[model samples]
Target: MNPTRHAVSLGLRRGWTEFVLSLRSPQDQGFYLFMGVGTLAYLWFNRDTELEGTGLLLPTFALPSILGALIAFGVVIGPAYALAMEREDGTLLRHKALPHGMQGYVTGQLLYHSLGLLPLLLVILVPSFLLFDDVMSNGAAGWATVAWVLVLGLLATLPLGMIIGSVVPSVQKVGTWGMLPIITLSAISGIFFPIQAMWGWLQAVAQVFPIYWIGLGMRSAFLPDAAVTVELGDSWRTGTTVLVLAAWAVFGMLVTPRVLRRMARRQSGSQVQQAKEAALQWVR
Candidate 1:
């Protein structure tokens, strides 16, 4: 096999390994449980509640939106934290020494993080089916819509995470630079509420980002046709969602490689040492 292909294959295997390890790790399992339970609890409590204008129950409306938020959150923060930590721990430096190692490393990050989303969706989605009715309104077509939207959303947002991770000074900084903004965006992107409830300018701003569109697409997938009454413009705007996500994916595809290349080029023993010292200081 070609050397680069060999590296990518190893990376894919590494990703799968990491995912399996994460599943076995007590801390990670706890996190998954907490998220799944918390989400299900929230939705369960609101199971009987109805949307004001649409007459649809809140859980059915919120489930897909929450799924989108989880996807956006996972793909972004996962890579950011991973890159920053690995950079400090000399993982990137080690990769930098090899032929096409960065390629392999990036492939691993994408695979691991993307696969990481499965348990998150499954834990909630499975219970949701048992607890709620008509949760999937558009039937087969909606599932197809979900597949595309998820692909586009991941393509759109994962690169941003890589970009942020490449630039951030430390893993600690990811909280400030990555987590805060993403969490804030989730709030405004209508994961828990309607975008139409926000100010017009804020709505416009939210629309510019993929999170909003992802949530919108998820809603379109899960909600009945009548639920469109609550969405902005009273439509799913599927075409616009695809366009915006595609644009981000394109931008990321063009820019992330350059950024990663720059970052990789700068990796050296001294920088990795400094990063380690800084991390130790943080621990102290």
Candidate 2:
């Protein structure tokens, strides 16, 4: 087998093993449960409320957007945390010692983070259908849209996480460098309300990021044609969503490897030891 392919295969297996382990871990289980329950509770409480003039139930409008935000949040933050922690613990250095190891490590990360999303999605989506009416208006077509939007969203956002992880000064900095930014984006990205309600420049800033397009693509999937009136330009802008997400994906693909390489080149035993000592001091 080609060396890179063999490395990737190993990475895939490694990722699967990690995912299986995560499923059995109490901490991960608790997180999944918390997110599922919290989201469902929010939707349930708002079940009777309608979106002002749209005549759509709040849950019906909110669910897809929430899912989109989750996708964006999960893929980006999850990898960022993983990479940062692993870097601090010498995992990246260990991988650097092997032939084509970085490739395998990256492959593992991509797969692990991508698969981790399933439990969260199932937790939210399954019960959501059981509890909500008109949850999915377009049926098969809607589902197909869901599939593509998820794929593109993953491609667009996951690299940002990796890049962030590769660049942050330390694992502790991820909050300021990664989490805060994502939270801010979610606020402006129409996950909670219509984007049109925001000031014009805020709307433009929001549209520049993948979170907005991901939410929009998701809304387009589950929402009926009439829901477009509540969206920017009064259309789903499916083409624009794809174009924007693909552009991000391309940018990530071109940039992430270079960033990772630079970060990798700087890793050393002394740096790792210094990180450990810093962590110990912080813990103290």
Candidate 3:
């Protein structure tokens, strides 16, 4: 088979299998519960505490702040770090023995881990309807825009997560180091705070990251006449964050499989002793 066909068939088949097996793992359950509670708590308190002024719609602060945290901190970093750990403990070796080996295994692992976000999304959405007593009022256009934003956000952040998973040297250090990126990205993305308040250069710096666009998209979903549009020019509305994220996704698409394969081979052949052989294979 050609390389393209081989990768796709393997990736799809692997994603499905990994997704299923992941659900059976007890740790997956706890992950969902913890993330779900966080999303719910943020949505519930958001209206009363931070968004009381907006009235009848999700405030600019709510979606970006809340969803940003849910997406970046938990959905993005959690799986990436978890996968990193699994690779270290020799669990990934067992995966490499399976059909389609590490590529499918890692892809599936990401999708499987991201499943926690589904319930978390629902948890946050429900409270917005019940407690906030408000709707986006953006109608079909608004909802469609929001969905695309969310999808783009997912696609963009996912690759970065994979890259982080692949590049990070050890799972043990993921918490110590990984959490910093998650938290810092969350802040810069303007998920928990306003980026516009920062200096122009700081805002420019924030623009270099994905959190900014993701937060803007979330805010646009609720804010009427927010002038949110995607362009590639110097305009702030050019969806730079989403585009950067898409680039990362492409980067992830290329890098993650190679990294997984290398790790898998190292795992199979004894990583420390066979590191050079595995790394060479990965580059090829």
Q: Which candidate is the best by lDDT?
A: 2
Best prediction by TM-score: 2
Candidate 1 per-residue lDDT over residues 166-271, each given as its tens digit:
9998888999999999999999999998988889998888988999999999999888888998988889998999999999999999999999999998999999
Q: Which runs of model 2 end up more than 4 angstroms from their true locations?
A: none
> Which residue pairs of candidate 1 clash?
none
Per-model CA lDDT versus the true structure = 0.92, 0.96, 0.62
Candidate 1 matches the true fold with a TM-score of 0.97
RMSD of 1: 1.1
**Per-residue alpha-carbon lDDT of model 2 for 42-144, expressed as tens digits?**
9999999999998999999999999999999999999999999989899999999999999999999999999999999999999999999999999999999
Over 209-236, each residue of candidate 3 has an lDDT whose tens digit, in order, gives: 6676766766666555533322123243
After superposition, candidate 1 runs with Cα above 4 Å error: none
C-alpha positional error of residue 207 in candidate 3 after TM-score superposition, expressed in Å: 1.1
CA shift at 57, candidate 3, in angstroms? Answer: 7.4
Q: What's model 3's lDDT at 198?
A: 61
